[model samples]
Target: MRIFALPLVVLASFVASAAAEYSCAGPDARTQPPTGAIVVDPTGAYSGSFHNLSEAVSNVPNTTDEHTIFLFPGVYREQVLISRLNGPLVLQGYTCNTKLYAANEVTISHAKAQRDISPEITSGRNDLTSTLRLKTNDVKVYNLNVANTAGRFLENGQAVATIIEGNNYGFYACNFTSHQDTVYANKGRELFA
Candidate 1:
């Protein structure tokens, strides 16, 4: 019994240490933009334009500090996940209504049916989760519309437009449009729209 207990205690300690090492602190905040102008077009490369939002976010100097990504006016049809590990990130759209259209779409009846059913049934629904999942703090998105337009399918439940799980996150002049769970503001305390 003593030998078994010793091994269990050691395993528990190791697990705790590993969990503690994982942190959500973002890189040093920057007061200025990292690049002159970062454009994201479906038909361009690194010259200044990016083919996707993730590429633009990936090009940001993760180790150098905070930075900004200026996205040109276009309908970005992809799920954007902003991680907190990459320093302070600012996604600025060229136009006031630059839309980030999530591929997932949810209708009114579909949303109602899911709510009436078991939560587990809805848990398997990725479209109902969020089109944009934010895992970073101090991140701001300006003049953009994040949405999940994937209507009911046999595969899942409802669709979520945006999921905010970061602290001190701000959405300025941005629209989060969806049916149910339009914005899942979870865990993190500080959030502003």
Candidate 2:
């Protein structure tokens, strides 16, 4: 009998790829939003101020205004970098159960590898390669699905789903899925439920 061992990194990548292959068989079931919740619909069918998630995040003033962003059912493909938020911020996703991440219908994803960086940029950390990077304090994310679609067959380096680099941040009922570096809580006080 012959036995061959695979590296842990390779094994992890295989598992991630296997999970990625699994998809929803049909269209996502619709659910009514919470009363008075701001809605963001990609189809322009809803009364939303912005169509894209980045625009919604950008519309918010940098001051401590304390705002909440409600994302409707959709697969948003973009790299979202939130920085210098002096006040409280809440990003909510459409879900049947607010306390359970399994019912989340919103997915924010992006495909970016570490090797695609330019030479001018130094300190090429995984934060720069994240799909969603939050650099503000007092941030709360609820019932949201954040993913990095960079795939698991990369030649080098890692991809991240969410980079938490702020103080007093809380993530509740959120599903974070990625091949590598799914959730990087590097600094400050944070809570994940």
Q: What TM-score would every model get versus the actual structure?
A: 0.60, 0.77
Q: Encode model 2's per-residue lDDT on 1-193: one tens digit a residue.
A: 1233457667888998876544333234235545544567788887654687898888777666687788888899999988887679888887766656887889999887676666577784688889899988899888789998777736745788999888998888888888877888999999989
Write out the backbone clash pairs for model 1: 84-136, 104-148, 104-149, 104-150, 105-149, 105-150, 105-151, 127-159, 128-158, 128-159
Q: In candidate 2, what residue range of length 10 has the lowest lDDT sum? A: 21-30
Provide the overall lDDT of each model, using Cα atoms, as 2-decimal numbers: 0.58, 0.79
lDDT of 1 by residue, 1-193 (tens): 9999999999999998876544222242122234664556665643657777777766766664557776554567777767765567677655412232221111111122243346666343443356777788777776666766655534444567777777777676566666656777775765454
RMSD of each: 18.6, 11.8
**Which 10 consecutive positions of candidate 1 have the poorest summed lDDT?**
101-110
- Please state the error at residue 172 of candidate 2 in Å: 0.9
Question: Which residue pairs show backbone clashes in model 2?
Answer: none
